[model samples]
Target: MKKLFFAAFTLLLSLCSFSQNYQLISGDQIKVSKYSSDLDIVASDKTGNYFAEQRWSWNLRAKLYKFDKNYNDIYEKDYRKELRGSIFRGFYPIDEELVMFSTEYTRKEKTFTLYARKINKTTGEIKQDAKEIGTFPLEDKRDDFEVKFAPVSNGKKLLFAANVSNKDRVSLVTAVLDPQLKREATATIDFRFTPKQFSIQDVFYTANEKIVVLGKESEETQVGKRKKKRWVFKQYILHIYTKAGKKEKEIPITADQRFAISGKLIEHTDGTLALAGFYATDPKKKDLSGFFLSKIDTDKNELLLTSYKEINASMIGQNYTEDADDDNDDDSKKSKKEEKKKDDDDEEEEIPNDYVLKSVLINPADNSMVITAEISQLYVYQTQNRSGNMTTYTTVYSYTTKDILLIGLNAEGKVKWVNSIPKKQQEKYENPNITRSEEDYFSGKTAHPYFSSFAALINKDKLIILMNDHQSNNVNPEYGHKVKRVYNFKKKSNFYGISVDLVTGTMKRKMIYDNSSDGIMMPRSAYINGSTILIPATRVKMFGKNELKMSQLTIK
Candidate 1:
């Protein structure tokens, strides 16, 4: 199988094409011209032939648009006035119709309600009135509320999860529905935890209509001869349920060397589920040193945990350069000053093990899975001033991204191969002085740098990774690292696709789309539909305001 994949990767190299067959989906023609922000492309079906998008207009008006396979505009409707105080969640295209869900937040009453509407995909006509599926009361104030409504789709079935938090407990209410917006069943689970000790990692809706929840359980214990209380991060708690919300299993996985970091939950082709994540090596540290995969066998009422496999940092991408002194800067240094400088340069940076596990792609053809994540770190700085007895302190936050890693796992959750695609990205921003809304907290600040989130496109023969590269035109081949930062309203970015060989772990990057000078590409809104990649971009228009355009990259 590996040989066959390698051969296909080699064969695709000869057929490589960098020229983009651009399609301009002008906002003007589609009645979505007001705002270029919040653009996204999603397919209604698995074949990627039909697509739809829900975006916000310049006046904060939410609208929906649909398109055919050839990128032709079909319908566009604005629902801002109709769905007041509501934010668009997601949409599902069923045959010739569309189901759109939005979460409405009532500030005065401090409440949230899930609403759904059906529309004709071709005519842009709302076929059904906005129906309230469920309403949830907020425990926190409107300004401090942070919980969000999560909606997921499994083939033709739809599921929605709304979280309500009290003093020390959180109630998760999940509802299963059909394509017609009919509720099938509802499940509610309560999680109790001590503040700052335990946290929920993620909640997923599996294809088999099960609710799987992953969370961290922490407790303090005595270790030293002094018997001092030491906080030991406990095991990961997995709560799995049936479609009707009955608790089926509770698996407490013991952490190996360090605390486990939970990622995505992948549903296998054979009805089993795989929980993928990494574990830190030291309890005192937060860096990941090993990868762990767990399988929840509902049939046997058994939870299988694989031995933690150490991750080879060398397999990471070239975005980071080694110690500067490792290179011969003059064979001999006679000056004492030069020798001292060389010694200082010899100090190498220890890359952190913490990575943001973004996605997991399953390949049923060869019974393999590809896990994707990026090395990221948050740097916080503080400044203090003291005058006599009075003192003041200020805090700032910054983020950095290093190389991306891809690991291939077999059916049994064993690591088959590993590879890295190197790139350096960073953002300079200050901590928010004022409180933000729940939407801002969940969607991230739009002013920050936008990075592509999809792990990789799994082709029959090779793996395709899409990333942001500001220096694609003048990349340095000698070194594997490049640094770019976006501060204030100034940003420079380009999209690059890296192709990796499954068998040999070889990597090659090609320019997918470049922003002409001052423009920016919105990667969060980018979507991979079958063999094509679609993303929205903002370019400088006449009045210094930006004009919205869509870039479509076809994959052969």
Candidate 2:
């Protein structure tokens, strides 16, 4: 298994050529220095064609960029002419045409329309066939709900997750589109949730439409008291939906108290479906590991297939006794000093044992369901900084690891061999502002990390995740502005992109275009192109102005 994993890894890298400075497979690294104030990569056609709508500003001005088979610039135009809000939502393909849409932002008391447009594949012209599907009611102003596009049986469906602005009540709206992408039929779902002291983190179905949604919905209750009170996440929940919104089954990740579901649904040509994701359980006192795999399941929701366990992240810790040098006395003395130092280091910082991406996939045999997930780590540190710092100095700090965890379950839902990915090195980033802390952090606000990572499920067991590099601009010396210091306490995290193994939860690739090295990582947006991945990166103009830069990577 190790040899096979290595062979596959080597082959992936060999398929492309990358220089330390930049990575490219086709198209000279074009310097597209435009800011996509907001953007979304709709979908890559089966032929590997990419199309997306990139909004350039907070003021509702933006354009669309399309790429051909070779990733060459096919066309670009301003799609947001009179559209009020240009916040990006998602992309989907119908037949031979591409459809893209952005969220509607409200300005003033009046409400605007939620627009969806179709693009002409051959001419690369923007088709004004855009129509407003729904409106954001005054009672539904919360940012938790968003629209996602998926290919349905005939045309396509837009899945909108709706929940009460400040309540636990959640609703799933499935809007089927017509040939021109007009909303035809809609399904309102109360969906399903457990009453076991858990939250619905994600909601989606399998590739072949088998219902499967993942969430770190732990049976957690507060323990301890006041300042010392802590919430323990016991495990992960994997749900299989054999029927549409009717029947469902649940499973638990039983390794460590920590498991994160990251990946998508896969529909195979041979009438099989699978789910790809991983978990981060405490291997020892120091290792946070993960594994990725393709799960198989059938309509009845029985565990018929599973894969070999793959390692996600593992650290070399003080838990292991030292392999002393030949000189015992001197080495022993040094070891004692190092041991003390190691303990001190452990107090303030916690290493990321594993990182699983949250993505969805489909089974080629039948595009029946979707894969939705919201998996969180079992044991993670909630770093609090109250030392006069008003700005959130949040960033995903990375650590190295070896060992990839891979698992798979089949359509019959049989557990496959849980494989271990013995990778040599791995990397991780700090997530901020997403986790829940009953007591607001530092200045009375939640400071838990956001899952700034995303993934895409492709052919084979090969999955791709772009773990976003996040950092606060107000605190960043190079990026921060003077007056902006006043707003430091309320800034959001930014993202840069990285590639990791979906099966083994390992960093298979990393490249930063704007900074030469992995300076300030930002996942401006990404698009899939054959064996290559095109990521658009932006850097503030050298003159303190915003200037966007683009980076394209050919993954071997």
Candidate 3:
């Protein structure tokens, strides 16, 4: 069946028409603000109780939202004054107390200081009586620094990875902070850099307490050299530290070719690290070259499994040829003068089909990790005559394309297997007529491009996969067109969710979210206890959006 998709956002114009609010009843969730705020939600404990957050502002404040087991808002307080620092980074809820640290920059002395605090669960929000302790910023110029927390064998401790000194080589500094907010700063773990190149962008910690550093480096050029130049690319370095802050072992990447990089690290109970990120090829190889990566590694830095295999895009490009020809017609045929003018004025190359293809849990396992990515396709094609011979001269066409990437690494980092969700098997193989013509555009089919958003849980023996399909502003918003050409794709938002068996790579029946007359469907949020699920939901409505509500779903 052919479906209509458009952006008839004629009514959602009023700003006060802000969307409704939702709270995950069974999980620790914080409603930042009714309209806009820096942080929607950040750190939450395993049991889904107490959660800490960093407000999004230039001089933002850190707040804690402790919800009762029933999901009632119990306490709301601020901690900006307690730590007495201009800035704060690492934070989360723990046990019966809330433990967090602070870092500040002393502009006058050009120095940095770190501090910490342990508040009772009932401490009441950021009170004047709230006692504070521990300085983490280490009285030096920690120009480039970051702090994080991880589960340590002896107990949970803070892991600070920053520079040892502004003048010294950049190092990964570690400090252990327990529930009591006690500090046992480990010796600095340094990540060696290239000659005259030293800087780290960001870092993450695994369950086993190993650290993965991700960032780029740059080198200066000499005056008389083969033209001074500047190049930047991402690099990865792995490190394990002792309780005293000394290095236990280090594994560094030896890829001679460096390109821009951004990545995340997750820790597994079986002591392995799951890494998910994307890389690009040279600008000249844009068409013949694209990028894709999926890998699992042991805690010790051994490559467990990887899917960097190239995706032959020949089929995709060929589809563009047949489709492109449909744009021109015999009625549009031009005389010699008209044809020659059209050829010379033509600047836009023949565009190719762009797909944001991805998958999850390629190798499902009890301890397998979930990795998701978005690969954007951008391509162009041009034709050139092979020879100048009048009659035998044949023309050939070639294309150039670029891939933009975005990745999300699960909090725990590892999953049983990545669900290899396939792309649409050519148009005919896909559900019929999901695409429609653009009401506001020239002659061309404006497909309702789908962005697959998923919510997954790594349970004891299974990987619960909740998938949602969104039209993501793919087609143009329908204007005042009679048939809602542009408006066709506008309100076409239908959501779907599913459950999967990680060990067997299997899926089950699903849930669908429908839209309303006002064009809204805030679907429901979910929580998992053992194998049971309690979902806060909104039922499908015929003419209006559903009321904010809740329900339960059983997976047998």
Candidate 4:
């Protein structure tokens, strides 16, 4: 009997050891300059080869790296001399070629020109000649200039659009390019709204070879009876245009009596449109109470299916408190009773605040969808100082990114399951030094920008989430207790991998590795290539020597 029991226990241990369905491979460390701290994966090819852009702290020029299938760095190219006075836009894979985009502003002519050059994917050699994509005249050299690129038809075609607003109206210079970097069509389209009241949010190339532009428009209106008047969001608009820049349809999306705080538009394969977002009933409050999904019949100008799901406390998981140890105390029991009574007196359900929908994944086979949202908030603190006649004001911003919410929906737009993964992280940045505006800070201009968020991928039947967490979280693998807050990701932080069963919403978590001995892994820089996820890790030393490596996680 003793032998049988021992054998059974051994088998259980082995089963527990093989629970994780993935393998992590850490590549060899390579010495890099101290200024190169962040790496972003720009593009990947069909054969599992990828390209990364290494950013420097001092300049806009970046180094390009080409990695092989096994995460081996095979080629490197520096762009400092080649792009001396130009701003690097991005590197993208259009069709079978890797294209690099850069912009040059000629102060004499007050013109900003966008140039695109081809790069050899395997050799990392950039072509000397560049093709001019667009040119815009600017009133001032300091004015903001941006060019938007959208890939369509499984990356077989590219769309470029830029705002060329004038005094009277807002206009966009749009162009469509084929795989060979040849312009198929170019035209200027009017937005029909003033620049101050409307802003373009996103551009999409539809499945039927059409252009869809999403814009947000705001207007001022009276709110209260007399003196409490204010302005808020008016409506969101969508303009659908043909490939030749002819406007086909203009649709305005509005929530009945409620404010649509945030939303995302999705284009189906059959030329249908869907909208998903969060909503708030009270205009005075920014907290969202429910989420809605709607499918639209564009031709009929009506909604085919609309579903609204209220987010309650139970959907966000139990609120675990640190006072569990004090449960036996009399005062604690009394306090809990009073809190419970107060909760019972209130009729409104507790809901999550500052949650933003991040990504929506649609399964190709059945059209079932999974949506992911995160709690992101920014608090600004101000301080004033007086030195004789000179008065100075300083500002500091505290950024918080918390729990991740996952919701699953069937093909008919019905909610199947909902789950929340607990996590807490905070990052602080001071003004006048690092960033000039909140938008710049949110764009990752601060130090240690990629340490706070998570990277996620949806595999065949599972949703995988990778994040840097506090070391103590490994003690309770079931995630029953309150998540320990990680103020900063450092060497002591542990990298965690969570796998969720898509159908049942069941989750399993494990600490994949610790950064105590290796280095700090940036999860936000992770990208999926085929069945593998690649992340960049960096270790900075006291001097100018730094070590960089690639970590790959392959789903088994």
Give every collision pair in model 1.
288-353, 317-422, 318-422, 318-480
Every candidate's CA RMSD: 9.5, 12.7, 15.5, 8.9
lDDT of 1 by residue, 1-556 (tens): 0111111011122334432222222222222343333455645443223333334433234566555444455555677676666666656554344677777767778777888888666566777789998887775654222333344553566556665555667567778767777778777777667534555556666656777876666677775456667555566788887867677888776554455654556677665777787776765444556788878776554668864578755445243543344223222223324334533532321223447676777775777777887766544555566999999875644455666777877766788877665555554333432222211322222323344333367665567776566553234232344444322112445656666666555666665455554245566556676656666555534454455444555555
Candidate 4 has what TM-score?
0.80
Write the residue-wise lDDT of candidate 2 on 1-556 in tens digits. Answer: 0111111011122323321122443233333323333434555664544534343344435455556555556556555554454554445677666766655646554343456777666665667756777665433444434444545554344443333222444444445566666665444545344324344444444446554555444333443334343344455566665434554677764533544433334545444555555544552224444444444565666543354344422221111222233232122343335435644544423233233333434334333222223222222333334567563543432222222233333443333333332221112324522222322111111112212323343433344434342232211111111111110111223332333333343333432222333222333245655546655433333444343323445443
Per-residue lDDT of candidate 4, residues 378-448 (tens digit): 55655567999999976755566778888888888788888888777665554622322322211222334
Q: Which has the higher TM-score value, candidate number 2 or candidate number 4? A: 4
Worst 10 residues of 3 by lDDT: 423-432
Model 4 Cα shift for residue 97 (angstroms): 0.3
**Global lDDT of model 4:** 0.66
lDDT of each: 0.56, 0.40, 0.38, 0.66
In terms of TM-score, the best-performing candidate is 4
Better of 1 and 2 by lDDT: 1
